[model samples]
Target: MRTLEETLAWVAEGTALCRRAMAGLDETSLLPGWTRGHVVAHLAGNAEALGNLVRWARTGERTPMYGSPAERDTAIEAGARLPADRLATWFDESARALADAMAHLTADQWRSEVTTAQGRTVPAVEIPWLRAREVLVHAVDLGTGVRFADLPEPFLAELRADILARRGPANVPGVHGDPAEVTAYLAGRPHTGVTTTDGAVAEPLPPWL
Candidate 1:
């Protein structure tokens, strides 16, 4: 990813983008599996969860992102039912609070190790990437038409690297297209019109997150 400033800027940009998408949405379902409220609620919950990790890094405590998987799911579900205006506010406010926490981190805190919900131990610096990925990727998942091609190149590159590292070596023949499209497909979004070395893909690789 880019410098922390640049990465945090993307975080802001993504938050704005998501807020716009959320604002334009009605109580109608998001056209696939979820409602706009559900997606917005998830974003809010995610910002709070990521903030927990940031606090852990700053204070040298072992704060886990979520209390438990079940609690996380419950929060998202209940949050989805909140009024649209309040849900959007929660989304924006949580992100701002997280950014505030990030801004106060000392140099030493940047290198402090933290545990992710998935049990991975990584430097606190990775928290921004986690937020950026959630905001951008899940924005697309919102079905707001924020396609993969809309994501910035730098974010896509880092996202690709993160996903590949997690999934290990690319075992299947690779999908080919523009860098953003390939990254999108690999990151588990639908990348229609993309072709594998053997032509049309009958199956996709495992998800990135």
Candidate 2:
């Protein structure tokens, strides 16, 4: 795992970038299949959900990130219809609330194991990266034209491997491309302009996440 300081910076940067992506744009398909409002709502909800993991770490209780997938989706939909300013407030405040919850964890508490929504057992130390992943990846998913090339290379590498694992992909094969584009392709995003090792432009890849 990365140091707490580094993970905290990742969380902060992701939130900041998401905020920047939402600026001055109407909620018109910002996430392609979803609106800007929907994406913001989901981000806010994600912070609150991830905070549950922090709570579990601090208290040694089995509080879940969400009760059920349906409820989670419903909550996102409810928040998605909020007026623009209110949605923005929810975004900012939810992130802060998660931070507050995390700040209460002691060193020992930080090592507590938790069951993620995926039913994987992981140390509480992973929460920051989990939240950061959602924030940063979905920020780019907002269709704001934020290029994957702008992400930190280390973070991009992690995301690439993650998507590939979930997607059941093989090796890089005959593909060659800018690191960012390859990472985005791995994330199941629009990865235009990436080329194969044979110098041919690669085709659109499947959704991995």
Candidate 3:
């Protein structure tokens, strides 16, 4: 786990990566069936939704991330249709907004409970980690040449642990190697260098998101 300050810095770095990758919005992304626009749109919406949770923490209101999963999906699809420049603007503004909200959080506020889109209830401090994962992973998903190796080691380790915790060793069998390679394999991203305990190339895993 990261300190709040470290997590905020992580978010900033990931956000910068996304900004650089924004130039490829019109192109196909690593995510099959979704363009880079779709990925960025989802990131923008996610930042805003997380802002709602920050507000909930600060004010003691129960602000859920989204009204429903379908609502979140519809918003992402609609946002993806915007012109490229506007889509970039949307991502920038939402990211800044979420960062600002997180920055203003009191220590007590950081500990306040909030529910995730996946229905997991967690403290507000997890928001930055969540946003970090979003910006960094989706930066690669933009498919403009960013690779899993481009991500920070600490973040990748946390991500690998999270995937294993959620999906389990049974779901990601024969996995062992460099942190980046393991994370890439676990995330279902295009990867190389991952190997099993026997030193053989690791098999591909199903979707992990």
The most accurate candidate by lDDT is 3
* Span of ten consecutive residues with least summed lDDT in model 2: 23-32
Q: How do the predictions measure up, each by TM-score?
A: 0.91, 0.90, 0.96
Residues 1-209, candidate 1: write the lDDT tens digits: 37888888889878877876665444543335567787788889999999999889988888899999999989988888788778888988998999899999988998999998999899999898889888888777777678888888888888877787777655545666788878877876677766887777636655564
* Counted clashes in each candidate structure: 0, 0, 0
Q: Which residue pairs clash in candidate 1?
A: none
True-structure RMSD, every candidate:
2.1, 2.1, 1.2
Query: Considering only N, C-alpha and C atoms within 3 Å, which residue pairs clash in candidate 2?
Result: none
**Candidate 2 stretches greater than 4 Å from native:** 24-26, 171-174, 198-201
Candidate 2 Cα deviation (angstroms), residue 52:
0.5
Candidate of highest TM-score: 3
10 residues in a row with least lDDT, candidate 3: 169-178
Residue range 49-77, candidate 3, lDDT tens digits: 99999999999999999999999999989
Task: Give candidate 3's error at residue 23 in angstroms.
Answer: 2.0
* Candidate 3, RMSD to the unseen true structure: 1.2
Clashing pairs in 3: none
Question: lDDT for model 1, on a 0 to 1 scale?
Answer: 0.80
Backbone clash pairs in model 2 (N, Cα, C under 3 Å; residues 3+ apart or in different chains), count: 0
